[model samples]
Target: MVIPWLSVLWAAPIIGAGVVMLMPRRALAKWVALAVSLLALGVTVVIAAGFDPGGEQYQFVESRRWIPSFGTGYILGVDGIALALIVLTAVLVPLLIVAGWNDADNAAQRRSVHTYLALTLAVEGMVFMSLIALDILLFYVFFEAMLIPMYFLIGGFGADRVASSKAAVKFLLYNLFGGLIMLAAVIGLYVTTAGSDAFGSGTFDFRAIVAAVAAGDFAVNPAVLNLMFAGFMFAFAVKAPLWPLHRWLPDAAVEATPASAVLMMAVMDKVGTFGMLRYCLQLFPDAATLFRPLIITLAVVGIIYGAVVAIGQTDVMRLIAYTSISHFGFIILGIFVMTTQGQSGSTLYMVNHGISTAALFLIAGFLVSRRGSRLIAAYGGVQKVAPVLAGTFLVAGLATLSLPGLAPFISEFLVLIGTFTRYPVLAVLAATALVLSAIYVLWLYQRIMTGPVREGNERLRDLVPRELAVVTPLIVLLLVLGIYPKPALDVIDPAVGHTLTTIDQPDPAPTLADGNAP
Candidate 1:
């Protein structure tokens, strides 16, 4: 009998959340949540170990009848793209559990530690489900449901109760509005498929739908398809929090605890970009193609806008939040470029960004907790008092700027190369963020971690063992992946190629200087 790996992978954290909610002691709840997340990580490792990069497009797939009347099923699967994200989510949650060990204690709102841990696990499980679900309805259900726990995380526990509460509401409202639009698209998809001879009756199986669309078996009016595509893309872009639609992200990230904020930015937000790659492109290839230039323009604008705004931020955490908006632009740019390198780099960027952002944000949170302020002016000469903490913060900062020998560098490099090949002007515009990123990152570090020992900063403590445990792995990953990204690229490349094939996009052929085809 074969193991139902995908089912187990998503269910473990969710079930653990229930178990944690039942724990009598807050300490036990914390340990149990950590263990559960580690178990999930172990499961992901096993799946990765068994997975063949060159094998079937979707692996460890599981399907069962569910709501037969509506043609939705309990479908689950992972391609290399989803698998990479699964690994990212799994790896981060355990560290977040440790990093947030005391974040809920003495909350102004009287939030319990157990409740916080349980909610974290709940978000993890739901995110896991969203990444693996092969049924569109199934994906949407978890996609929207994850927001509830996240809302509570933002509102129920934080240093500033009022700000946290307000941010939580903003987060919920924006995502809920997006979800409602996607609901219409979901229903519209079913209606279109049910009316077509291709599916005979409506079905939510993603693979089946993609196959039918590829084979031209599910034909609909182009305008109708475009509308449905817009519905899906709107939700994803909001979730991706693409510019103009991204107002909710900074406030939410600033008001929440560092762990919760990292969870939102690093893990949860990837779903938006993931949905764009997985659903928007495959299900509505023509619509994606039609919207490519417009999306690329928006992405380039976001890249420059986010970096410029980040340089002006007074709050350290909010500064990092703006930087993410910029990094996300790179990810979106890679996806819409419709080249294998672009998509693969975008996918890899998702993972690299998650690691780097989590590291920088959490380290900053640690510093903030010590000084009891998030303002950049609150500290100077931190390195004199806490060299270990300062060093880690510097490394994470460098990684954020995509410095050479950091994980983000290779991914960012790939995105630029991919973008330049097809859209040189836009790529050139986006590349300007590299200089802008260095400016913000180095300036932030100089203000907080350098300068003569500031008053009151003299007694600051260095990273304790627990803090070291939380940050070491992330830094190591940045170094290892930066130096040798080929292992990750090997797993990611084939899936990217498959996605390109499904959308009928071939890499542009090389040409001679005279513009002759090579």
Candidate 2:
């Protein structure tokens, strides 16, 4: 059973932030942050170890009446799915702090970074809680609370303050609009439930409402359902940074530093996809089915468009921004297929993307530290001056291209294979996106590392010991997850399979697209 560590886990990062603020020296802040993350990670591990795979109906659940006036409660729980992300958050935050050690920002900036790091951990905790928040309103609160730290990170630590803050404003406005719309949908869900005695008394419990809707006890117009689905999906897609609505991502990534970028690109971005899995499918299955084709179209478009644009990027950061768009396109493709393999692949992709992206961003950070610029043409033959650094980048970049032995390769393969059953033609098109990834990944590598050295590049040094401490674990994780993904998958496969079954759509039987069999 899932036991509630909601209080403990939530308290860890906030306390760590307080300690960091109190600590006088930068060295002490680093140690404090590391210690806090490790502690929280241990707690997450303990929660993971205690999780019972067979009994996944929200274990470690702690629910109490809190604000009965609005029909909400202090609710918390975790399933295998939420646990995986919680572990990912705990593992990544400390690594991000260590990765940022080489940043040349001023003392005030460092303070802001440390405080932001703490806030990120705090946000991660809320995201963790919200993942399993069974009550609708409680879930909404934790969900909206994540924006605070992210806004500061992008606005405060971004490369060009003016531009970064502008991007943050755009992101805030877009998401805020989406969130406000979703609130209306949430109110609708509550109002529909009000006819039942349990809900008529004003309860926001999701399970009861789902039961009421399913039994046709809740009289919701089909049109109303469709509108609600649109509201929720729009918010999630914007967050997923799906095409059309994804304009915020590239701009934000371009301006933010590696550490801050990791928060936005790696952790926070998953919220969109997570919302799809949890809300769209979980709460509005009919509407999700209705919207499938349109969403899939956008996903495939993003896949190809992102790849094409990335190939033309002149700046490394901008190129990475586009590459992520290309990659998440596959993720959404897998999710829409509505099969066990597809959903599981999408989940695995979320985790693997976090690992691969952290590596790529960190590598970008190293290059920036040396060249003082992110333009691809700003330096060449960096390997001559910093062989270790270039080699690390090569490894990371190959992984980005989904090199066969790396982490992304396995997850990307699973997603593509999963999609072949439900979307033969789209899956075929998705394969081309991988090819484009290879072209740009390698192209980026060659442009920056293998050509003739440019002037002023001779002074760049290989990764120092401190930097290695930050990067080594991420690289090792990529390899480890690639070769032996059983631990992660054991959690993912069953969870995703269970989740898909919960939705209106069940697994679509397979038909091999490569012409092996019908």
Candidate topping TM-score: 1
TM-score of 2: 0.94
Query: What does the lDDT come to for candidate 2?
Result: 0.79
10 residues in a row with least lDDT, candidate 2:
102-111
Q: Which lDDT value does model 2 have at 200?
A: 55
lDDT at position 154, candidate 2: 73
Candidate 2 residue spans exceeding 4 A from truth: 1-3, 102-104, 107-114, 196-200, 211-219, 510-518
- How many steric overlaps does candidate 1 have? 0
Q: Per-residue lDDT for 66 in model 1?
A: 94
In order of appearance, the predictions have TM-scores of 0.99, 0.94
Model 2 superposed RMSD (Cα)? 2.6
Cα lDDT tens digits for candidate 2, 1-518: 54457667867877777777777766777778778888888888788888887775568877889888877787777777777777777788878877775442532244454565566666666666667687889878777778777787677766577887898888788778778888898887777666455455667777666666555566667798899888888888887888978888888887777887887788888878887887788778778888888888899999999999999999998899899998888888888878877788888888888889889988887778667898998979999889988888888888899898888888888888888777879889889987899899998988889878888898888899878887899899989988898898888777786667667566665546585645
lDDT by residue for model 1 (186-302), tens: 999999989999986998989999999899888899999999999999999999989889999999999999999999999999999999999999999999999999998999999
